[model samples]
Target: MDSDRESNSSSSSTSSSSSTSSSSSSLSSSSSSYKMIKAKVFIWVDSELKDIYKIDEKLTWVEQKENIVTKLLPPLYKIVNKKYSITNRKLLKMLYGRWRSRHRTSNIKNQGDERVKQNKRRSSKNSRMQEKKKRRAHATNYLIENKNKYILRYPEEDLVKILKDSGYHSEEWEETDPEEEWPITQSAVVEDDEIIEEAIKQKSSSIYIHNKWWRSPALLRLLHDRIDPTVELLKKKPLTLKRKRAQSSQSRYNTSNVPPIGVPSWCLNQDALEQFNYSNVNIPVYDYNTDDQDNSDNDIEDENNNEEEIQNRTNSS
Candidate 1:
């Protein structure tokens, strides 16, 4: 009975210890699984972050430096490979050394794959650029061969349509005159006196008025009256108008010849006829003498003009 009782106790102790060990194992496994899931979630989040941008499909040097140190060495190898023209046993050894050091690095297992992916992407880009250059060269050669026939000068809309019919992709060209593009109204073309005054008032630049007195006849006469005394004092010399002495016979025969308008007259501006001075003030005595000579010359010119007209008419007939 004693032996059986001891055996039962031992068996019970063994069963309890076994049950405790199983429970502890289960708890440890569960904790490991939780830790693995958390680590995976952190990695996924870090990978997707925009600030964690990649270079050459893998993380950039900045990103890898922050998260994965082991990937940094092979990229250095690539840089050295690009920079130095000498590709020899030394460079090969250095690359091998980096590649082998990868296995010894404990923390970053993904570094090797990142470097490989970067190299592959870089290779693809180089190949694509080479292909593009080849295509461009071929296209340029084709264009050069047919430049005279294929090239269009100042191409119009119809040329674009023709190109499109011949399977070319063409964009629309815009042609517009710069002057006609301004938004000028018809009223602005025929501006009124008020508008003209406003424009002159707003004008910032100086205008040279050639004979501004000609625009206002009243002002011109007022100026002439003001400056008359100054003119009389200028007696250094006087330029006389050339005149022909009237033949005594012709003078008597031509009583019907009225004086032409604006003849010289000192008698016209008399104060007794002040109102008539403005209307009938003859040209200045000196100016009238000059003008009379010009008129007689003009009459001679008119006779010559009539002769030319008669000759032209006869030629035409």
Candidate 2:
């Protein structure tokens, strides 16, 4: 009875230990699953290492970056953790902003509004004509405004460099308000038009100007005036003055005194000229003698008879 009690106690202890081990393993797995559900990290992972990992929410920025680096580059993980570091807020904001920008989309309603605007632009003729008129007006105004001040139209970057090279500081220019320096007004436009005309008149005397200034308003106005005159001149033939040849007093021959060559007597006689100028020059004459006429008639009859015989032979064959 004592031996059986000892054996039963041993078996009971072993069974309890096995059950406890299984329950502990189950609890650990459940705790890990709960942590994964709570943490909202959506990082891309390698297929081979796609296992869920436990992350601490209270980790420092540097610790988070290190963690990310470790996960992404495992081979260099140890080196980075030991040497590299980054602030938590900056890294988080940077990554979040980048991802959001890349993945963000516009609403369908906004896209529909844009499509409607495009369709209206395509279908309206009045709108297109108005746009063209506006463009021409703007171009004309631009031409008038920069007539004498074309040199001042350099790009901001180039202007800045030029100012620097000339020992002029930007601070001085910035301190002086443009309104105070040159007040703009309605009369400025009128003044610009007058200036453009004056500049065009001045440029008319010069043959050429700098290529950069070729498209200036003054030049355009000059070209317009020049083109009209040229077109009108082209419509009419140019007048050519007939220069008289001066006679030489010492010369032996004189064109005025020279006489024309005379025509031959044969040329003057029309009937004789026509007769000799033909391909059949030999004229046929009828003989008055009866013997000669009879011989001629006989020859003609013989030719007629031969031609008839040849025709009959060809038809029969």
Q: Which candidate gets the maximum lDDT versus the true structure?
A: 1
Q: Write the per-residue lDDT of candidate 1 for residues 1-317, one digit (tens) a residue.
A: 64464455445544544465577569879868655644443343245432443222233334344333344334433444463433434433433443344433422435587766555544543453353333333332222232311121112222223222311111111112234333333433235544532111221211111121111232223223212222332223452322233333433223223222332233233431343344444432211222345556654454355446546765798
The clash count for each model shown is: 0, 1
Worst 10 residues of 2 by lDDT: 166-175
Off by over 4 Å in 1: 1-12, 18-22, 42-47, 50-317
Give per-residue CA lDDT, model 2, range 10-46, as digits (tens): 4554454345547856987986754452232233222
Give each model a TM-score: 0.16, 0.14
Q: Runs in model 2 with CA error above 4 Å?
A: 1-83, 106-317
RMSD of 1: 50.7
Instruction: Give candidate 2's root-mean-square deviation (CA, Å).
Output: 48.5
